[model samples]
Target: MTKATSAARDDRPPLLALVGPTAVGKTAVSLRIAEALDAEIISGDSMQVYRRMDIGTAKLPLAEREGIPHHLIDILEPEEPFSVSMFQSLCAEKIREIHERGKLPFLVGGTGLYVESVCYGFEFQGDSGDEAFRERMRHFAQAHGAEALHARLAAVDPSTAARLHPNDERRIIRALEVFETTGRPLSETQAQTRAAPKTSPYRLCLIGLTMDRAALYRRINERVDAMIAQGLVEEVEALIRSGVPQDAVSMQGLGYKEIAAYLRGECSLAEAVERLKRDTRHFAKRQLSWFRHMQDLVWAEADEEGKIDDLFKSICAIIAGKFHLDLEYIR
Candidate 1:
């Protein structure tokens, strides 16, 4: 391995994770935080990694990035499979480079698993699936239903089964498939490869952004309307016309999925809009729950007018206190 890759795998410097639910103004607050800290932004979002997935993923434009250097966004095609392991590996390299440059690494966005994978140094076994193995699993899922496949998984890999949602039959079946192919439980392999906690080379300061649910929901609703006005429907239409798969991860994003359903005549446009609003609210709730479960997170609430500066100051104070870093130098 190259020096850069080796350093990335081992070093954990003073890192700041800015995380929250969708449409919670994380982008705006993150920009301010990056500016204040003289840091580079490493995107924690999974969806934002794909190119040409801008409108539906709500990706930040180059202009909106405000000259703040960002890593790991728009680096993949919508059809490619980008896993959390890939994210962890790439982000670790980015963090190392940022630290080497004498700047802080600010991890920003709402993808919980991506953040947690790095924070906890979670290990993912290599998924080198043969077509035959995958076909067998797919056939099983089809023949017996996802539940039956999940039952088989539970019988073989209870640890993975416990953590996965029953409805997440896709993952359940995949985990089982991995076990069958490798003759080892996926959970056990991950547990064995797990790195020591805080052995992370960076000193991480996690900052979580939040707002009143009602207010956040209102923001989400308004943002959806704004996206529609900004031609989100047309954007989705373009992606479909370009032959992007409806089941692709990029297409499964909050706004993309709902709008794709409308395009496919599965729902009316108005109904899709309502579903987008409702699903985004639920997503925010889940984001909050995930952040609450993480350790060492500093919380900041959006101001009444949603001025990002207020939340930015709040986050800076928390980081300074936690890391003993000088705000003056950062500013």
Candidate 2:
């Protein structure tokens, strides 16, 4: 493992990222990690950015943040659109300010694309050429199995293609589409982003939290049940009553979409709940897949009550030993 040698450099600010799936206990653990490192948190979640979209997103209650200074939460209304480029620019500013205020920046959330943008300094340049090409590639993959199309990508852009599973036909085709339209390999684009010297001011380490798949699935089921008890159906009903379109991103989230189906007479409430559970499990699986591909990361579990604190302590020890920062200040 090629660890970074510098503690604080001019290019990138030191950042510690806590990323995992929904219902995986990210909020509590992130708060502990923040306290341990004297860090302020920047939420990387796309959904949590909206104000009224609270319950569906499992957003941290105001009491939970406990004056720890979390950024980028509740910054938009559900009606507005937020993009990766907007997130990147906003986070960069917040990181710089937090560092100047003598606090570390902790990025915490389950949004993989948003986290990757901050970590890799990805340019969210609009690729206007991808849509049509992507549709054509998708049709081709559908006609001739996803494996064969992905295999074709592996021959041309092995690195980028390697990140995709054979079954992830969408991303595989998108990568191929990017290559076809741009005339530059997706691997080359990714490498350029990775190689581009970071402009953030913090050093960073990534931590991943996971548990047994069955256990995780159990927790997910419980969470869905709890969301239902918390009036998730009523929430969706209100959104529908208010004339919010089903196609809106806010409505497309796991709980909202399923309940919307129930409201439309497509399924029983019980069936909707089951579908929600299954969809959430699949979403968590995708999240874990993305996190597992990260180059160097620490993984922990959320079993006991203080387990998150213990994990935070472990991370603080590593950061202190490596960067000469005092954990006391953070505590």
Candidate 3:
């Protein structure tokens, strides 16, 4: 290989990310990490992209970011569609830009797919934007033969082709559809996904924060209560009045879903709050599960006997140790 080719294959940019279950103090802890590393923040969150979701998503107000440059929050309308592929592309660019500026890209949020996709370079064959391609494939199969479609699939994704019988016209077309949409063979995408946790394109430090189960649940409940007090119901009400559908993907988020339920008279306010609390606790569990499956996550206790300073110090130490930096880089 040439020198440039060799370096391109061997060298990967450094990426630092903090992730955790909701209400686990990631925000406060991330601010410290950003300041310590002179990093810019890219939110690895799915819901925070929608505008007017402030209360439900718990977006940190700009004044409270401590002058940290944060990206990928509030960049979408509630009606627009977003997917993991979009976040992966946008976050990759942000990471590169941060590197060019001689600073770190600190990805901080709770969205598991969004965060891990960037860490491992998951090539997402996003939402089916290939109905036309599928139609054409089906037409070609009908006009020629299932055997011909199978041959074409073999030429592209032989692994997928080998497993599929020529008579399986639907599946053959689907695989070809995937190849057409993602510009990569379907087999390669599946293989990459299977190996994602084991492979990465970045020198990574991923920090996860957790606390005692009962304590985390308690915090979640309190956060739900606080959101109600902070007018979460009103926020949902405004979104609905502004023509955001109750079943929109953004509206389906934890707080918005439950409160929108209450607004539609499907439940009372008290019942909605209870459901939100329960669903949020469940969401936190799923988040933990997702992170636990990923390799090389350095875990820290965000509780530490309810001592924020202690938890922050421990997390800082984990990152510093992971990347071989002085732990006291915190300002």
Which candidate's TM-score is highest?
1
What tens-digit string does per-residue lDDT give for candidate 2 at 143-230? 9986898898998889777666565565577678777878788878866665556543346677777777887898889988998998
Instruction: Judging by TM-score, tell me the better candidate of 1 and 3.
Output: 1
Write down the TM-score of every candidate.
0.82, 0.76, 0.77
Worst 10 residues of 1 by lDDT: 1-10
- Window of ten residues with lowest summed lDDT in model 2: 1-10
CA lDDT of each prediction against the hidden true structure: 0.79, 0.77, 0.83
| TM-score of predicted structure 3 | 0.77
Q: Which stretches of candidate 2 lie over 4 Å from their true place?
A: 1-11, 127-201, 304-306, 326-330
Cα shift from native, residue 263, model 1 (Å): 1.1
Q: Which of the numbered candidates is closest to the native, going by highest lDDT?
A: 3
lDDT of 3 by residue, 153-256 (tens): 99999988976546556568878888876789987876667555467788898888888888999999998999999999999999999998664668767798
How far does residue 284 in candidate 3 sit from its true spot (Å)?
Answer: 0.8
In model 1, what is the error at residue 42, expressed in angstroms?
A: 0.9
Instruction: Compute the lDDT for candidate 3.
Output: 0.83
The CA-based lDDT of model 2 is what? Answer: 0.77
**285 Cα displacement, candidate 2 (Å):** 0.9
lDDT of 3 at 238: 96
List the candidate numbers ranked by TM-score, top first: 1, 3, 2
